[model samples]
Target chain A: MTSNAAGAGTISYEQAGVNYDLIDPLKVAAQRAAAATAGHLAGHGFTEVKASRGESAYVVDVGPFYLASIVECLGSKALVADEMGKLTGRSYYAGIAQDTIAMAVNDLITVGATPLVVQAYWAAGGSDWFGDAQRAQALVEGWKKACDTCGVAWGGGETPALAGIVEGGRIDLAASCTGIIQPKERLSVGDRLGAGDAIVLLASSGIHANGLSLARKLVERLPQGYMTPLADGSLYGEALLAPTVLYSPVTEALERAGVRPHYCANVTGHGWRKLLRHPAQLTYRIDALPRVPEVLRFIQQHAQQDDREAYSTLNMGAGFALFVDAADGQKCVDVARGLGIEAVVAGRVEAGPKQLLIEPLGIRFGDDDLQLR
Target chain B: MTSNAAGAGTISYEQAGVNYDLIDPLKVAAQRAAAATAGHLAGHGFTEVKASRGESAYVVDVGPFYLASIVECLGSKALVADEMGKLTGRSYYAGIAQDTIAMAVNDLITVGATPLVVQAYWAAGGSDWFGDAQRAQALVEGWKKACDTCGVAWGGGETPALAGIVEGGRIDLAASCTGIIQPKERLSVGDRLGAGDAIVLLASSGIHANGLSLARKLVERLPQGYMTPLADGSLYGEALLAPTVLYSPVTEALERAGVRPHYCANVTGHGWRKLLRHPAQLTYRIDALPRVPEVLRFIQQHAQQDDREAYSTLNMGAGFALFVDAADGQKCVDVARGLGIEAVVAGRVEAGPKQLLIEPLGIRFGDDDLQLR
Candidate 1:
């Protein structure tokens, strides 16, 4: 299981060919351009909630309600699933579907909106790719299961076969969801995220759909490939492919229990660095951290990535974070526990520069690491 | 312009490498699978308006409002623009962005929902594709223009760089939109379609966003590549790259004029055959077909496609259709005209088997041709 050398040299996410430096500028430009069209919402008797523009989802002010919409792709993780399927002959589409839905719904719930409908966009290089009944059935069943888990309807979608634009036999899975936050008070745009608020870290299942490009690159160096077993005797690929945790249930439970989180962040591409994603300038002091998942540890060791690179690029076991009043911190944790989610008050918000501090690892991430806003 | 021999051989869309026969069944299966999750809407205090599924968009019943959502891809049409850009040194991404938005908003209005927000999903095979500042800026500017034209807010979207799943330097563009049908009476799910309903056909800018795979295949055989001149003295690629007509304005005008369409269909993939997309058993008899745009004529002649194959695959000049009361047909056309859309009363609905008959072309499409339901 440990045949491959852990580290001969240093490696980074950008070294594996995925660079946030090039992508972030385009995102910022796109946000500015999209802001120009927000005035159109008034034509339909709705108002544009400008605060939600750069957030995970776009929130619109409809009469008596606010609607949140988000469009997200599962990224190159589907390709990893395809590769793993070829090696083991086991259908990995179910997990891919779950990851795709999770990417969208998790972002939707960041604003405290309950997802209503999820529409899919499955663009394949060829139509024959779906001929594999087992894979196709797994994808459909998994999508339904994810939608059911999030309490959202599986709306109709488009399955386009782009022969030349997409690589043959590969499917690019993405989904867009529409959610609602009724009574308006449930809307959590981080406006109330104040100092002394508790930061509860929700446990992630595994990789959870981010940093797959780097993970796939790491597999090329693995002598055993997907068959490589972790310390727990589980296949590396299987562990990484574990379906992402659906945090919608936890958010719903928190709302039901009257524990309103001032802000929520889905720990994804930016890893634990997402802890300081709130627009306000506040230091996130993390005194504790969740146990690192085995799959992520394997990735860290194989890729020779240091703690900074690993925590900035991968989820590192923490899937989500919730900021709530100090008095309601334990209540939020209890609500998540009631929903079978392992969570704890891992940190707290403090008046300072926007930065994250990991007390155990002695690591810190400045606001510059998360350029989402 | 007339150098290529016309009708030298019988050409079908399937021969060009796209077969709806195999694609339709999967669509049917997907629709069935998605239906199972509709019950989840109840958790959000909304209901799945069952009638909206399988239509151009999925409509959900929210309190005091019905929301219509659709996720559509631009298909390989952007590749056409990419090819054209390589040849002409012109940035065609502006038109490509418009086409992507048109594909979503056109379907959105089919159910009488005024688009409130449109979110984009741009999956590129490489991150450096956006480094071409000219091309990227054109895309941003054009996307904003389309949103402005449709009077919808441009909600932010995901720009994923999928290194392996998509072709390098190429992007697969798609978008999802959420719309509102207020006063509920404006909802048009074909329930009002009757024998005497008149069908109005709106003029297409060119090929729109469908049949690009076949079109790209035809380009391989072009004698002059993108520089080939058509009878009208316009380059073939430039003609095909014409921005899709934004029909949201027309729908808005019609609704403002109190002319609610019995049903509406975006003339895209499956071409004019989309006229019979309604689940009801009725014959759409076209007494007057819109003049085939020069671009379609060029493609049909060069590809050796007959009227049947041409109209069944490409838009062939008809971009959108509105089924309305016989007396209100002229009013609808006038409304479209006021919005600068060339429209005419082209047909009428008759009680019979679900099919479309183009009287002038002597072409008929049976129910089997469109298996959307």
Candidate 2:
């Protein structure tokens, strides 16, 4: 089942047409520029939490509480829904809504913040894109359901009909969430991340939302497209459209149990390499990895991607990762299980060069692979 | 000179290919579906301020404070920057940044909220789009400048490189803001929009982000494209790319002066028709309208649009509108004047059917023109 056995040459994400190498520098520049405007919050009686920049979300210190904010998009996954709808006549927007909400609130929870409200930004290519009542209703219901799942209010949003910038018949979905971390003790900024912390991996529903452009490229090569059957007998696109796992409940559960994570990372664009996102030079050594979802395996096979490339770009199977004290690892897994989520103590933090080592697949991501700090 | 003298006949926004008639129903349906999820806020010790649902932003009552949140985009205005850059060999993203931020924080201040943090969502067509240092630096500097102008923190954001959904070589910019209203009495929910409230008009710099698609289509017919000159001698594209006025300052000034507005509306998209956005059957009579900016007049002349069509589809000159008690009208205008923004008492709210009357131009927008509830 391992993609390493394919013996295919390494296919870097850049080869598939997305080069994070070019984007990281711009992000770094934007962070430095944004940091200069931190003084503006002083007049509002709020202080900027400097360390929150370049992390999953921005944290601001109000008088009585800390607010975490994040703005994220569903990426090109909405196109998957569009293509699937054209083929199956069933709207996959419910999953699209979940993916969009998951992208925002999931990042919010990484800072130990409870999402208070989520506002959506749906930009369509044209006005007639919403003429399909079934599709529109699914989007609305799915957005509300995702909000209910995360226990946040469905704040109002803007739906602009951008006729030219966006492609016709497709919508670019993005959301922003404001979350609150009360008492401030629950904040996970990696200040407490140290050697001997346990690494826990939470199972993903499928590809989640990353590497979708490559996935679509693979679909184009498939003879049957979305109808292509996998070993499990499900259509390729159906498996890819599985609703993202909402990890906010895991954080909420840990808060109720009085367990604080040293750091948390949503395994998204950078895949499992996100496990080493902490600022400190600590190695995340994975002795055991979660089972790769069938959808990801199908993508790797169809895309002819080797293990090192696939693991570095796609979520594989781990949707989220938590670093906590070694003794609390079992309790974290038990909490996730209580909530019907499959989680395991897959690895541990070690005092070494910042890197991620997936021993089973013999895959290693060097420190240079992730340069967010 | 008024565009009505051109005798070019009416040029509806729909004629330029943007039909709000098709988008409004979907928005109405979305509002109804979103209303059902308001109850979820109760679990977080917050109650939904139901009136805020269909307004410019959503308000949530959290303990002693009310929070206002909004998500909005810059529409196709960035395309103007791209096209201008191609012609002028200079980046115009700084103005694009201001327009995006203004679109979000301006709506927030309508409900009397002071912006605390604004997050950005910049989705590019490809990752390398940011490789252009001039464009990236301009976007960063402009975004920071807008944050400083609005007196809010430059919160974190996502810059996803959407390869297909967004047009290549251009970026789609959007922003979301979270603001706080303390002591709750400052909330402006239109309940106080009485018959005698004075209508105050704030001068716009030019076409501030709305109707850009139409503006671009007009450019296609021009002999010189972005270089075409208007009466002011500035290029048509440069005039149209004028940075949007951040009205958060006007609201902040009014709040500091203890002059509460009955209601506020950002004059975008629906243009002057937005003046009748309140759910009351009141007539907004404009005895005097702001002078049309040269950019809008140029558009009207070239597109062969009449005054009725131009004013109803574009801001013309009014950028923001505020309704205050007839007695406090001068004070509100004085507050804006103190901030270096020109404001005038242009009209009065009268008890009648929902409509907008521009006396100087002899134009009227019946209730049928704007159907948003």
Docking class of 2: medium
- The candidate that wins on lDDT is 1
Clashing pairs in 1: none
How do the residues A1-373 of candidate 1 rate in per-residue lDDT, one tens digit apiece? 1223343565576776776677777777788889988888877778977888777889999978899998999988887788789989999998899999999999999998988999999998887877778888888888888888888888889888888888999999999999888769989989989999999999999999988877887776778987799999999888889999999999998888888889999998878888777778899999988889999998898777789888998889899999999999889888888888898899899999888999889899998887777
Docking class of 1: medium
Report how far residue B59 has shifted in candidate 2, in Å.
1.1
Model 2 chain A: ten consecutive residues of lowest lDDT: A1-10
- Per-residue error for A281 in candidate 1, Å, reads 1.5
Residue pairs that clash (backbone atoms under 3 angstroms), model 2: none
**Which ranges of candidate 2 are over 4 A from the true structure?**
A1-9, A302-306, A361-366, B1-9
| lDDT string, candidate 2, A262-363, tens digits | 899999987877877877898889998888899999888877778887888899889999999999999999999999999999999999988888998898
DockQ of 1: 0.76
Q: What share of the true interface contacts does each candidate keep?
A: 0.78, 0.80
Q: List the candidates' TM-scores in order.
A: 0.97, 0.94
User: DockQ for model 2?
Assistant: 0.73
How far in Å is the alpha carbon of B147 misplaced in model 2? 1.3
